[model samples]
Every structure is written in structure tokens, then in C-alpha cells.
Target chain A: MPENEFEKKLKKMMDDFHLPPSTSVWENVSRRLHEKRRRKIPFFFLLAAGLITAGYFTYHVSEKYKQNSTAAISYTGKNADKAGNYLLKDSAKLSTQKPGIKKEEKASVSNTLPGTQQKIFKNELNNKLITVKNSTALKDNSSELENDNAGNNKQHLNGQIINENNNAIVSNNETLFKNSITIKQPVTPADAENTLLKDEVQDNNLALKKDSISGLANQPGNSLKKSTTKTPVTINKTSNWQWGVTGLYAKSNLIENLTNLNIPSAQYSNDPLTSGNYDTAFKTTHAFSPSAAYAFGTVVKKKIFKNGYLSSGLNFIHLSVKADIGKTVDSVIVIPSPAYTYFVRGYAQPGFVKTNTSKYNFIELPVLFQQNFFHSKKTSLSYNAGFSVRQLISSSSLIYNQINNIYFSKEELLRKTQFQVAAGLSFEMNTGKNNSFFIGPQFTYSLSNLIKNPGNSSFHFINYGLQAGFLLHKK
Target chain B: MDYKNLVRNCLKGNAEAQKYLYNHFAASMFGVCYRYTKSVTDAEDVLQEGFIKVFNNLHRYRHEGELQAWMRRIMVNTALTYLKQNKHYSSELSYEEINLHPVSSENPVITLQAKELADLIRQLPTGCQTIFNLHAVEGYTHVEIGEMLGIHEGTSRSQYARARSIMVGWIEKRNENIKQRRYAGK
Candidate 1:
């Protein structure tokens, strides 16, 4: 029986397929893709949350402020005068309750008269913004008005006759004068609260008003502050100037899409020297670039359609670059070199991983055209689209030159300059009163080269990268 | 850290427990990820995602087996996902065509320095190394390796054999290097 040698090799090749253990593997693709390239969440989510929180706290504070205002109103200027008048009116009414024998007779009775009569009180309060002070005053007045029922009794004693009422008032003038002194003592502010509470026969409305007044006086702030207040006020401050930091990373052979001409080696070394089938135009050259960026932009807004504004500005980006391409890419991870075996012949693939680090500097300018998707008095989210231009002023690259039939180092490869174009989406978030932090990925493609050698070669530099930034600007 | 206790506590949703679990398993899992990845950043990406799966599936652990084994399974699956997405390793080569096979030898590449062996192993084409690891060390049958690596069993066998041959050559060269060094030292 003859076994086909080719069949055996095929069977063996199939058998050699090494499947890794079926465990959790590269599920982080979503996260990295999100970090590298993805659309941003609409600003409304955060904006809504912030607004709701602020509104709630503001409402709570406003309620507290209103309560404090009521307390303060009870203790001041026109309010004090109203209190005095109320007490005086009540004093007169009480004095006139009984028909007088005569002025001389009433004067003698004054020595035995009770002090500080209760009075009916009512002050004109603005209907628009009523406070607890008004409620207390009105409530106390009602209760006190009930106590005035005694006056009805007086009317019963002597039918509602004018001359008799005048007589009663003249006779009780002595009692009125005696009550006046005691009323004045209570209004002195120190015992005003205690005095208001103790006056049982006094009108309850008057007592309540006194209570609110004293309560306002007891506030922690200048409780005794003689300074008067009318209403609360608001203030605003303005400033403009937004600044931020930048980061950058650019490499010539990130994809290991080896371009550029490698010089042919004439000798050999311990390490294997690799070369492509010679192309006449291809010569050894170097290319290396890496960068990260920090950007800033100014927001210039122009009012356009009814109730709308158009906002746009100049975007400035700074990138940091570093390079050591051929060497770094070579040293990253050593691949497993295949062993000579009976099952396979002719050039078993040797494993190799290039760890190249190439970087340099560049600044980009982008003029973005934006449409305001959503807007408010203070902030907005705009969908921006425009052309971005990058200029390579200073940079470097690593050249893998074949020396003695082995690859070796060559530096300062970005001895020339280049340019590129970028286009992409940006998500802007208003971070403060006039500033914002925007980040979105942009796709950038290189349009030209960084070096110029006087020769003819078709070696091309092509790349597409996802760019991200915090859009620092004043709105 | 007591890894077992960490796994147990992590199941309870303690943040500290989760972090410890990550630190203990991340390195080896990264080794698995590196074997599958084309870039360090890509490997790191795999490492992050694999840990997330480990943490997420921790509750389903049921103490059925070793926690590390469960985590390893997740990492392998993660690496396979990368394979499914990229298919970058073995599009050109077929394993079934391999003519040479590695027979049992007294001197194997495993005896070489771990770093050097790793270096040698990484040199095999993407699909070949995967085949070698799956069939020779991991002990999956060729058929199973075929299904996981997306190749015919014969292709798997060929890639694995080619990988072994390359490793043996590297091992031989490294041995020569050591001998040369010894002679030089003497």
C-alpha cells in the first residue's frame, strides 16, 4: 500500500491547528473602539440632569428665603408704626366701654385701671407677594376682634347714643393715660415678645403679629440690625479666555505597511538579513512620526434666524511627537522561530513582532462649520463639520539601513516636512458659564511626505488615524 | 492575596475583590492575548475585555472547578473572537500540505530560556503558532483545533508541525550560542 506523501502532509497540517482555550478573549474591542473611535452621547442627558438638580435645590432655598423674609418683616419700620397704632386704637375703645359719671369721676377711677389694652389691627399688605407676617397679623386681629365682644355689652348697657359714647370716652381718659405707659413699655423691643404672649385679654391678632416680629428679631444675622431691607436682588459676572493641555502619537510604520527603500547589504551577520526582490526605483530611505495633541478654540456666535444664533471659531491644536521606529518595533516581542522538522519543508515561518516607537511634532488648523442642534440661554450642542489641515514643521523617522547584510539603525528621518487633511465629528459640552470640553474622533489622512530626496521612487506615505481632543473654548 | 478568597468575595460584588482578581489573572491571560494579538495595545485590549468577562461570569462559577481555569477559558474565547474578526493569521497557508512532522525528541525547545523560547515561538506565522500551542502543549485534538482556528484538521497539523520545526531550529542555534559562550568564558 502506497501512502500519498502530500495527503499525509495535508492531514498533519490540519492536525497542527492550535486552538486556544475557549475563555474570555478580546471582548474589550468595544471599549477600545469607544476610546479610539465612536460617536459621543448627546449633551442633553447631562444638561437635563444638571438643570433638574439645580432647579430642585434652587426651589428649596427659595422657600427657606421666603420664610426668613416673613420673620424679618414683623420687626421693622412701618410694621412697628402699625403695631403702635393698633395698640392705641384698642386702648381708646376699651376706655369708652362704660358710660361715664363725669370726667372728674373717671379721673379718680384711673388709679385702679388695668394696663395695656388689646387692639384691633389691620395693615395693607401687597397681594402679589404675601408672607407669613401677613397671615399672623390677620389671624391675631380676628382673635382680638372676638375679645371686643365686651364693647357690644357696653352698647347694650346704654343704647348706641353718640353723646353718651363721647361722655364715656371723656370719663375713661384717665384709664387710657394709665394704659398708655404700660403699652409703651411692651413696645420697647426687649420684652415685646414676652409681653405680647402675656396679654391674655389682648386681641389674639395683635399677639400673633408681635410673635412674628420678635421671631424675625431673633435671626442669627444682625438680629438687632437696624438696617432695613426691601427685596432680594441678583448679580452677574463675565470673563472670556479658555486654555488647555495637548498630547500626540504618530508612527511611520504603525501598520507595519513597510514603505521606503532599504539599502541592499553586501555582507552577512549572525542575524538574518531580509530584502525584497530588487526594484530599480526602490532605495533605502527613512520615515518615522508620532504625536498627541491638545487643542483650543474660540466661540464666535452671530444671531441669525429668529430666536437662533450661529456659532463657529478658530481651532488650534498642538501635537507632541517622538520616534525610534525600526529599532523599537524590532525589540517589542520576539516571535517563535520554527524548528526544522520532518512534517514541513522549505522555510518554516519564523515569528517576529516589531516594537517600533516613532514620534514628532505638528500643529493643525481646522475651520469648522456648525449647526446648533439644541440651544438654551447659556449653553448649546452644535454639530460641527469642516476641513482640518495639519502641518509638519519639525519631525523625525527611523531608517532600517542594510549594513553588512543586516538591518541597523538610522536616525533623524523626518528631515523634511509634510501636510494632511482631517474630517470628523465632535461632541461639545458646556462645562461652565462660558467654557466647554468637547471630544470626538476625527479621521485624518496624510496627503504628502515629510522628506524630499532628489530621486524618483514610488514609495508612498498613506495613513488614516482616529484623532480625539478636549475642545477647550469660551462660549 | 489569597486568590480563592478574592474570587469568592468578588462574587459578592466587592470592588476590592474584583481588583485583586484582575491583578492575579491579568498577566497569564495577557500572555494568551499576546499570542493572539498583532499589537501590544491590541493584547492589552484583550486583557481588559477578558477580565470583564471573568468578573461578569464569576457569579455563574458555582465553584464547579478552579477559578483560574474558568478565567483561562474566557481568555481563550476572547483570543478566538479576535481571530474570528481579523482572520489575519492563516489565509495564505494550508496546514494539510505540511510534509514534515515533529517526533518525540529528548531535547525539546521548552528546555531553552523562557524568553528565548517565547521569542522563537512568536516567529511562526500567526496561524502556525496558534496551531502549535493548541495541539502540542494545550492538548486539543487536531479536529477541535481545526474548528477553533478556522482551518481543516490537516491544515492545523501542518501549521503545528511547521511551528515545531522552526522552534527546533531556534533551539539548536541557541544551544550552539550557549556552547560558544561557555568556550569563550573558559
Candidate 2:
């Protein structure tokens, strides 16, 4: 049957038909075409703003906590000063009134008196109330305090009768001294730590008070009790900046999404017709494998919040992707032109058993936000998430061209800069007061395509790595 | 400047060259989009998407074909993709396999204006309308249309036949109205 004349007329008329589009069509199209380049600017600005806001919030919270801590220290110091001055006044009165007290009674009094109190009394009363002799008097006092348990509640300090209300004079008995000082029995195994384990105090009188407690703890009968709440204080040095060097080893994988780039299937495969269609180039017939990758660089980290930190650094990353290309053989192709014949030397592909490797190296700057969820005095565990802006330093590979049927440098197709998303958790061990060592597993994936003009094909690399680093704090 | 030079400048990210290229081909491309889509707004959407693809894939053009022809194919593909994915058109484009009787081959002279003809075509059921445009207007064979639209070749042929008969009925009715109006003027 002949084609319908109606269809012929319709085609002719439609071919000539033209309707002017609304002006907004161009506006939309133009905006979309240019938006790719402009999109990054706003994203980076938003990220920076977010970081700044988070840092500011963390700083204020940490400062408020520090202020509250300082207030606690001052409150504890004031009470210690009051106790010290009161003891000094009572010792003076005891020395004048207790002139006829026997040596036996004086020795008993020294057994219950704390060392700081005894030292103060000796100074104020001209060595009449209590005296410090290296081993002889102190040793006898320790044994006497233990055997005199029956008389623990009542004690005579320089023959002054002290009442239970704690107003008359300082006690020479273990029970009265414990009630007056509020110093619990030594809870630490170490004799030194028993006194130092108390919350940190800067006042001189408080230091002397703790020292006197240590003297009591050293007595022969005193038993060291186990301290169940042994908290090792971890100072968040949020204001201090730290610098570090990091190194990573990873397994890298390449992801390819073909869009418009022509794939020379004929060069890699024996079939020439396969090179014409877009799908043939992207088909899973070609195998791409990953090898070892490494990254190394210096980083600077600063604490932003009580548990948050913002860190950025420069790193050099070396990545390798291997493609299976059967057995490789040398081949020369002769090109015929009007006036010249060009000879191009390259590799010949047979099957998919052999492999070839390609190297892509990048210099990257990363901005990472880390928050520590767990902290001990000597160790901390934190998770970090952020992005990196990377510049392609070099690429080494021969790319196949469908149009020319020849090999070209892949550098021509690769973009200069790309972006990546990175996330990881780190376990940090504080080696010294101002230094730490950290190690963790990290994963980084590319956000931008590797190809400069990824017409139909998008290429990216994903890396799974173990990162280790050392940080030195700068005070 | 010539199209080759214009394309080269566009590749260099020259805004003026891109605008020039869009201005040169946008009207014809919009006409193509309008035929495939349901409304003027939908046509413009496809036109916008199509032009972006054209510019992004401009490097692959290879200068082997007319730039206008290359862009038109992109627009056509973009329209078909829009029809399948767009909620407004996806139900309309869903084709059911039904037997269609052959339409009359006797020519009914169609003297309607091009815009009038396009409007009538738009009024056809979207499934048949697309198959009609693909096979009748775009010159794709029934087999190619089946492959492009992911349907059986027989279904495409039947849908096109149904689309043609509906179009003829609309054209004939409009001709009768014109005739009556002319007689009243006399």
C-alpha cells in the first residue's frame, strides 16, 4: 500500500511550523547551564557559616563551665582559712593554761593532734604544747592512738577540757580530730595520692591542711581504704591550638557513570561495531579493580566546644585503579593521509586476563568537624565528618579515543579540582600533657566527577582507609 | 559567526555564544516540544531541559551533523522522557494493547492552519498522540518507535492507526463548521 498523502502533508507542514518560545525559556536554560560552577560557592559559604556558628556556641559553653569550676575552688579555700585562724588563737591560750600538765598527758595529746595543728601550736606556744621530733615522738604517737581506741572520743589538749560542740580547743583524739577536720580516712593505696586525691586547691593554707592529713594517714594503724570513685580529671584545653602529622593507607575503588563520552570499545575489545553505541562503552565487560592508596600530610586542630573540634589540613593522596586488559603486546598503527603517513606505537589488547594500573594523585585541603563522645584522663574517642577540596596533581594512563582510534593521555579528560566527603572515628591516647596519638578507620568518597567535561560519563574514586596521627598541643 | 565557531565559543564558556545558539534554534525546538507535550508550559519545560543537555553534550557533537538536527533529537528524547516520568503525562502515556480497525485511506482534504492542525493533534489521547507523532511526523518506523517507547511494534502500529482515525474525524467536523460559516456569509 502507498503511503497516505495525509501523512505527507502533515510532515511538511509540521517541519515548517515554528512557535516562538516565551522569554523565560532562555532564562531557565541559561541559569541551569551556569549553575554547576556557581553552586559550589554557596555550599562552601554555608559550610563556613555553620562551622563558625558551632565554634562560637561551643566556646561560650566551655567558658561558663570553667567559671563555675573556679567558683567551687574559691568556696573551698575560704572555709580552710577560717579553720586555720581559729586553731592559731586556741593554741596560744592552751600554752599558758597547761603549764603543770604531765609529760604523759602531753604525749597522749600529740597522738590525736594533726601535724599541721601540732606544728602551729609549737610555733605559737614556744614548743610547750606539742613538738616535732623526727621518728621518736611521732612513732610513739601512732601506736598510742591505735591502743587508746577506748578513749578515742574524749581528749585533753594542754589540760583544756574540750566539749563535743567543738568550741573549747583542737582535739588530741582520733574521733574529735576526724569530726573537726572533715577529712575522711585515707582512701587511696598510695600514701602520697591519699592527700593529693582531694579536689585541686591553690590556697596555701589548704595545701598545709592536706599535708597534715597525709601525716595522719601515715600512722601505723591507719588502714588504706579503696576509693571507688577514682575519677581522673580530663582537662578540655579548648583554648589551646594543636598541630599534627597524619598518614593513611587505603583500598581505592573507581565508580564510572557514563553520560556522553565516546568509548573506544574497539581499542579495548576486538569488535569494532561496539565502539559506536554509548552502552557498549559502559557495559560491565571491562573490569576495573582497586589497589593500595596512600595519603600523608600535616593537620591543625582546635577545640571548638567542650567536646567539639574543627580541624583542617593539607594532604597529598595517591590513588591507583587497575583495569583488566588480557595479554599486552606491542603494535604499530600506520595512518594514511594525503601527504603523510603517521606511525603510532601502542599496546594491543587480547582478552581480559591481564591487568593495567592507572595512577591519579591529588593535593587536598580538608575541613573536618569532630565531636568527642567519650573521654578518659588519658584517652578519648571522637567521630569526625567533613569535606575536602582537592586539586588533581597528576594522572598517568593512556586513554582510548573512539573518534581517532588511538591512545591519548587521560590527563586531558580529567578535571583539575574535585570535592570529597569524608567521615571517620578516632581513638586518641594522650601520650603526654601536651601531645597525643590517634588512630582510626576512615572512608572518603568523591562528590565531583573526575572527568573535566563528563558528557555522559562520570568517574569517581571511593577510598576506605586507616588513618594514624600524632598531635602536639601549642600552649 | 558560523555555527562551528559558535559551538567552539560555547565550549570556551562564552555566554554570548551560548545565547546566540539558543536564540537561533529555540523557536523550531519549541515547536517540536509542543507537538510531543500536552501544554505550552510543559513544552517550555522540555525545551529548557533539552537545551541544557545540548550545551553540556556539545563537545560530543563532533560536527558530523547539523547542530540544529542534533539539538532537535535531544529535545525529542527529553520530551519522551518527560512524558514517561511526569505525573501529569505518565498515566496518559500508559499504552494498553487493544485491537484497532484500519482508518479510511480516502483523503479528506485538510486545509487547516499549522497551529490549528497542531491543536487538533494535541487533543488526541496522549498514548496514540505520541505514537502518531513518532511514526507519522518524525518518520521513525514502527519498529524503531517500539524500541524507543519500549512497546511492541504491533502496539505502536495499532495506536498510530487509532490516532490517525481520530485526527481525521476532528478535521472533518471542523471543515463542516467552516462551510456553514461561509454559507451564512453568502
Candidate 3:
């Protein structure tokens, strides 16, 4: 290059010296873009197909849940006498927000009518109020208790116990209520009269008498009227959710065995794992996968259907497979092996066997039937049997090196996609609307081998896993 | 000048094209960030965060005449966030008490090698390096740099001119050193 021209060009380059990021970064990104589009080729169609299948599943599992439930509704003989009125109600009221302690005190008092529990709560409240008004020393303690009450109610499990102020009341009655309830002898008449008088004095300005509300079945015309504090009795709703989570272990073959005994390669290389040995040259193993699932969709629920949750979402899957690329070992013989023999070790043929490590990541979709027990109520035990499709997202491949740092010859390794059927049992959690977490165990059978193996199929290698997870949905 | 098209392309999710726009102007823009920050890593962080802001708010880019100026504003703001985060983590280091080294002038251009020029530019003690890049490469006025960096205008000018004069002096001394070695070889 000429000096002047070089200088001019150098100047231009100096004037425009911008460093761009490497092309490989973009190549990897664009490659992903193309792969994404390629995968999407069947995405909409599969989604539609899934929607229809899920719709059918959504329909029939619901029908099945109904069929199973109606048949099983009376499944539990806990009460053949009480029959359908089984009240396993999981309900709580927002009690602490009742504006005043008086209402709360009254409710407890009414429920006490002739009952020892009510008298105990009433005496506790009066002593607490008198203690609050009387002592300057106790004033500090009472206010402190009140402050502590509000904080704990907010932390209570059910919405009903949100009474922070109740803690102060409990603290005041701490010594009185802490004793055991079951007694060796009933209270004497004098003791009972004293308890009644204390209850009467405290009822000085209150409107309703405690006796009328007690023994609800015995309450006459005025009993038809409900007290403001008397909460509506809760009976568990028939629409219950099913959920569960599980962990799995699976072992499969990298290749399917060639069925024909007379085929050229079938008898040509006489290895018993190929012929009769259960241990094929290649082995696939999957370990420790946990998943949780829940079923929802109410038409089936209303009918007391067995299965109704049609679900789709992401699964963080870690799958590893080890491919042993050598002649079959002796112990795994499952084929008719008159022609082949197996070796525990040492090569029958002289070549380094190629071994490839496979790791897989996936997203799973399951459409299943969710069922309830004999009766549909607040909580139900449920199980699901469904077709599951897992899409591979990311995979890691391990390449082994020889002394020369050369890769083992692989005329193998790559194989077919999977079509699987999964059966699982889940414990459902329906806190509100469409929110839930399902925990359970699932078993999967791949109709199509991820890697094919043979000899009249040495027996099926299926995946056994546990699943636990949560999902978001429209209300 | 090209702000409208750049914002449009970025909003359309053209990543390669967006990266192109960043590369096209990041160094010159980085000089803007460096003027405020005390270190290269901080400046680079500010630059990255600034671009993230630019990308996220591309839709709000309403036909501004100077895209670089708009980006400069964001970079300045990002640098301020760095300062705030730094201040929150550690009480601001009181540079107020320490005196700055007085700058001297000695032109040292002729002795520079290609690799040495890049390296030396990289080494100008972050504060002066940035002022130098802004004045020499990015064509910013000292007043603009000062306003954006929150330094006095005269300080910006002095830092810029001092950065150049120091580079010239270093280059000259290097040339002399090379000459002495050559003579010794002979």
C-alpha cells in the first residue's frame, strides 16, 4: 500500500473507530429466533388440538368426576344416618373487625347458655374490663395487651381470628382459662348459683338473654330470628379442588431393538443385551423430578365429576441420559439369544465405545380427569390420568475425549421425540378464585422411545417422577 | 440527528439494529458519562443503564432534533443515579478537601504509536480521560460538558486542555526515551 493512501485510510479509520460486538452473539441469538419460529410451526395447531382435547377432557373428566362422585358421594359411611347434610365446613368469619369487644363478648356469652364455656368467657371479659378501669398500674399492662392483640390477629391463619385485641383479653384471663375442661365431678349447686349471678350482673344493660340462644333446636318463635353476631353456619361447598406433587425416576434405551432375527445386523453382531441381555449398549436414566398439579372447572364440579382440570404451563425439567456405545453386556439378556453372548467387561471388538451424556429441559402440558370422593364438599381427595407433552427447551451434551483428545465416533446419539401418557394424584388448594398449588406423584410411559432399543422390547422402561408446582389463571 | 429513526427501530424490537445504534454512538456518549463519574467502570455502567433507559423510553422520544443530546441527558441522569446509589451506600467521599494536581502544558503528539495512542487514551486518569475524549473526539463545548457533568465551566475547559497538554508531554518524553535507546544501540 502507498504511504499517503495508507495515512488517509488510517485517518478515516481513526475518525470512525467503532467496535461492534462479536457476530457469534448475534448468530446465537438469530439461531434461537429461527428455532423459535420452527417450533412455532405446529404451536398454534397443537394449542388448538390441545384446547379441543382439553375441552373434551374438560368435559368428560367433569362427567367422570360427577359419575364417580354421585356413585361415591355416599362413599364414606361416617354418617349414613346424617346422609347428605355432612357439614365439613372450612369457613371463618372476620371476627376481630366487629368494631367493639362487646359484640364478640355477647356472641361467646350466648353460645354459653347453661354451658360452662360461655360462663368462663363472660367472667373473663368482666374481670378484664374491671381490671382495665381500676388500676393505674394495670392501665399500662392493659394498653400493652391491647396493642399486642391487633398485631397477632393480622397474623392469624383464618380471616376470622383477626382480633388483635383478643390477645389482651386472653392475657387478662390467662390464669383462669388455662385449666383443663374435663372434670372428675360436676360443680356443686352453690358454685353453679355463684357462676349464674356473675353472668347476670354482667348482663345489666345487654338486651338478649343467653339462655334463648342455647340449645338452638329447643329455641321457639324468637329463635327464628337470628342474632347479628350469630354467624351463618358453614357447610363445605361441593365444588372441591384436587391437587398433588411427586418426584420421578426413569430408565430407558437409546435405541429400539430390531425385531427380525434373520435380519443382516440382527444376528451378525452377537451381543446378548442386543439379543437377550436387559442391559443394552446404551442406557437412559432420569432421576429426582418433583411436580404438583390441581384440577378445576366447575360444570363437572357441580355434577360431582371425577376429573376436570385441563392445565398448561412451564416445567423446569432436568433430565440426563448416559449412552454407552459398545457391545451389549451379559446380564441384561431379554432376547432369544442362542447366537449371542454377553461380556461383563473387555471389548469383544477392538474400538473405543462412544458415550454421550444428554441433559434436557422442558415445558409440560397435561389434560386429565379430576375426581372427588363419595361426597363433594369443601375439601376432596383427587387423582388424574392424562396425556402429557413435554417440549424440550435447553439441553447439555457431554463429549468424552480420548488420549489424543479426539471424540468417539457417533453414528448414534440423536433420536425421536416423545409421546407420553401420565397418571398422577394431586392435593388441590383453592384459596380463592383461580389460584392454587397442587402437590403429588406422577408416572409417565413414553409410547415413542426417546432413544430406540430392542429384542422384543426387553420390558418397558418408563419414567417415574414426583411433581409440585403452582399456576395462575383467569377467575 | 438520527434520533427519530433509531428510536423507531428500537421500539420495533430490531435488536441488531438497536445494537448498531448503540455502537455508532456509545463511545462519544460514554465520554459524556465519564465526565461526571470518577472511574471507567462507573462510567461504563452509567452508559449501559442510560441505553437501557433510552430503549425503554423510546416510545416517548418525541421527534427531538438532537438524539445524542437527548441520550446525553439520560446519561447524565444515570450518572446522577450512580452518585445517589453510591452516596446511599457510603457517605459521599469528600473530594472537597483534597486538592487537584495542577496541570501543565507540553505537546507530545509526534512520539505516539498506534497501540500506544489507544492505551494512553484509555489511561488518562478517568476524569481527564473523559474530558479529553469529549473535547477532542465528541466535539462538546466545555460549557456543555460542565453543565452536564455538574462541574464549573472553567474547570471543564482546564481539564480538557490539561488532558491534551499532558498527553503531548508524555508522548514527547516517550520519543526522547526511544531516541536514547536507539543511540545506545548504535
For candidate 1, the lDDT comes to 0.40
Winner on DockQ between 1 and 3 is 1
What tens digits encode model 1's per-residue C-alpha lDDT throughout B74-157?
877887675554434335333455665653242432345433444455667766766765665455777898887667777776
lDDT of 2 by residue, A205-237 (tens): 221222233443343333221123222122232
Kindly indicate the candidate among 2 and 3 with the higher DockQ: 2
Model 3 chain A worst lDDT run, 10 consecutive residues: A85-94
Q: How many angstroms is residue B55 displaced in model 1 relative to the true structure, after the best TM-score fit?
A: 2.4
Lowest lDDT block of 10, candidate 2 chain A: A121-130
**Which one wins by TM-score: 1 or 2?**
2
- Give one digit per residue, the lDDT tens place, for model 3 in B13-118: 7877677777777766665565556545555656666777776676777774577667766876776566555532124322121234454433333545444554
A450, model 3: CA deviation in Å?
Answer: 16
Question: lDDT: which is higher, 2 or 3?
Answer: 2
Q: Is the docking of candidate 3 incorrect, acceptable, medium or high quality?
A: incorrect
lDDT of 2 by residue, B1-69 (tens): 478899999999899999999998998998899999878878887898899999989999988888877
For model 1, what is the error of residue B27's alpha carbon versus the real structure, in angstroms, after optimal superposition? 2.6
| Residue A200, model 3: Cα distance from true site in angstroms | 48
